[model samples]
Target: VKIRVGNGRVKGVDLGYKVIECEKIVVAAGEGSKYLFQTLDIDIPIVIRRKELYVSEPYSLFIDPLIIDTREDSLGLYVTQTLRGELMGSIDYPEAIDDLTHETTLKHYTVYAKKLVRLIPIMKYSTVMRCWSGNYVTTPDNSHIMGRDPEWPEGLYISTGFSGHGFMLAPYTGFLMARHLIYGETPNTMEPYTPDRFRMGKYVRESLVIG
Candidate 1:
């Protein structure tokens, strides 16, 4: 787990360089990456937001495929079947908290779960076994931190702090980020997505339904 310098030879070094050299150094370490970036004097404030995911065992009923109820102006209770007919869901109105722990309270769970059961009726008696948490590192402007740094160390690159949309946009963002760093010629089509805009207050809001 440690990528630091070592006492013995490894990966072409008697010890990893106190300072290494590479064509590029990409910091895509997710929300937890802020601690490392601070070492390089890159001050990024990343918050830990808890998103709850549920796994439930079936009642004497059948629910097939993925049933997502995007109603009530929120991601409401989304129900999806597993290989064994178990269901998973989430309550989408994010309250925005620093509490990453997602020990589901019975009230929150019952309320959201029943919302789906009401819509479909088949899940009326399913028993939820667990609720868990995941983090979505969000930038203040709700975009990703991409592109090469203009000031600090040249050849250094940043690609962290995605505002919950990282997974959906990973491929295209990688292409654009690599092109900008490698050739200094980022496609103009994606120019507006650069992280620099956060400083200028020119923000772009995406109608990503899942959020």
Candidate 2:
């Protein structure tokens, strides 16, 4: 896949089989944004890290609110019970890798098991039904990248690098993005996330990112 730019503006996207024509384009590809941005021959401060999660067999409802462990020993551990009574959560992997592989390791599972048992002793008996891995598209400051820039293709915009808060912030981000695209006005809420901030050496530091 590639983005087509002509006369210093977004013309459309090349989807291998056909070109979808459009004047305005938003790149919200999450971890895949790096590849898409390469189509435009531009670079941004984005990194991809691997995260692993597991879901346990259903138990009687007990936990209500999401539990987060931010202690020095468990910096990225979080556990929450699903509506269906299944326990699900993950501990963030400390290392960052350049590749985009979704491979989960037994070491992660063992470590998580130990930590979860320590936090909720009853959880030691809960069987892990499944495990999975995913990518955390992150920025230098751990905040999302939003809005567009005048230097690039005129109609090209960006909205990625959520680190781990994409699902939580998607609705609000989309609303502000729509208003900006339609009325050509940058909402105050989005002012801090402009792609230009990286160029200006201004980073938005967010300390609340959890696993």
Candidate 3:
């Protein structure tokens, strides 16, 4: 995918086989945003890390709210029961990798299982129905990048690098971003997350990132 910019403004996007003309563009392509921005000579401070998660077989409802185990030994493990009674969660400890691969490793599974059983003893008997791996698009400060930059091409906006909180922060961020694009005004709440913060050495540090 190529973002076609002309006259210092977004003109369209070229998707290899076809081109879609547009006046504005919002880049929210997760890990792929790095390469997408590079087409326009823009380099974002985004890093990709590998995250693994597991789900246990359905059991009688036991756990209610999500349990965040921040014990030093647990490595920020979180566990929660889904509506279907399946236990689902992941550990906050992630592995930094360069490639985009969803390959699960036995080492990760073993570590996660031991930690889960240690935190919830009853989980020792539960069978892990499945496990999967995914990528976390992170930034130095662990917060998302939103809004636009005056130095960037006009009509070009960014909303990526949520670190691990994209799903949780999407609704509010999306709303604010929409208002900023439509009204040509950046909201006070979204001011701290402009794409130029990295260059400006302004970071919004967050420490409580749990799975």
Candidate 4:
């Protein structure tokens, strides 16, 4: 992806074979967002962490609600029964590694199984049939970095560093960001989440990060 930033604004983007001009650009590429902003001399502090998920074999278990067991170490353990009767869940582990790798871990599965069985004894009879991992783009304050850049006011906008809540908060984030971009107005609720909050020493803290 080619970014074109100049004259205190974004000129356009060169999509390899094509160049599309736009009045502004919003960088929300998750973990890849860091490098994209770097082209415009903007540094966003983000770390990529891999979180693994597991799915159990289909069974006739009546687990309807999403079960979540919060802990201080692993963030929390959560599981829910899908319509197909399969148990799907994930646990937030430590940030020991940094990379965009989809590698699964036997240790993660083992711990999840133990926690699942303890939380719901019926899960002891379940067996995991699949496991996968994905990248999480996290920020220092565990909150998102949104809003226009002060230096590039006429061009760049950012909406990344969501930690692990991007999927759940997409609808709300999209609405707020769109309003900010088109109307040049931001809701007071999102003022604390501006991209330059860290630089201005006004970082907001979010503690309910459940992967």
The TM-score leader among the candidates is 2
The CA lDDT of each predicted structure is: 0.64, 0.89, 0.88, 0.82
Can you rank all candidates by lDDT, best first? 2, 3, 4, 1
**Relative to the unseen true structure, what is the C-alpha lDDT of residue 78 in candidate 2, on a scale of 0 to 100?**
97
True-structure RMSD for candidate 2: 1.4
Please, what are the lDDT tens digits per residue for candidate 1 over residues 189-210?
5676665666667776654534
Per-prediction count of colliding residue pairs?
A: 0, 0, 0, 0
TM-score of 3: 0.94
The window of 10 residues in a row where model 4 has the poorest summed lDDT is 92-101
Question: Can you write out model 3's per-residue Cα lDDT over 52-109, one digit (the tens) per residue?
Answer: 8999999989998999887787878888999999999888555647558878778877
Q: Candidate 2, 97: how far from true, in Å? A: 2.0
**Where is model 1 more than 4 Å wrong at Cα?**
1-23, 58-75, 82-84, 93-96, 100-108, 209-211
Q: Which 10-residue window in model 1 sums to the lowest lDDT?
A: 6-15
By TM-score, the better pick of 2 and 3 is 2
lDDT of 2 by residue, 57-168 (tens): 9988999999998888985789999999999989976574765778888988998998899899988788999998898898999999999867888999999999889989
Error of 4 at 12 (Å): 1.4
Name the regions of candidate 3 deviating beyond 4 angstroms.
Answer: none
Q: Considering only N, C-alpha and C atoms within 3 Å, which residue pairs clash in candidate 3?
A: none
lDDT of 4 by residue, 23-96 (tens): 88888888889988777667888888889999989988688788778756444998898999999998876454
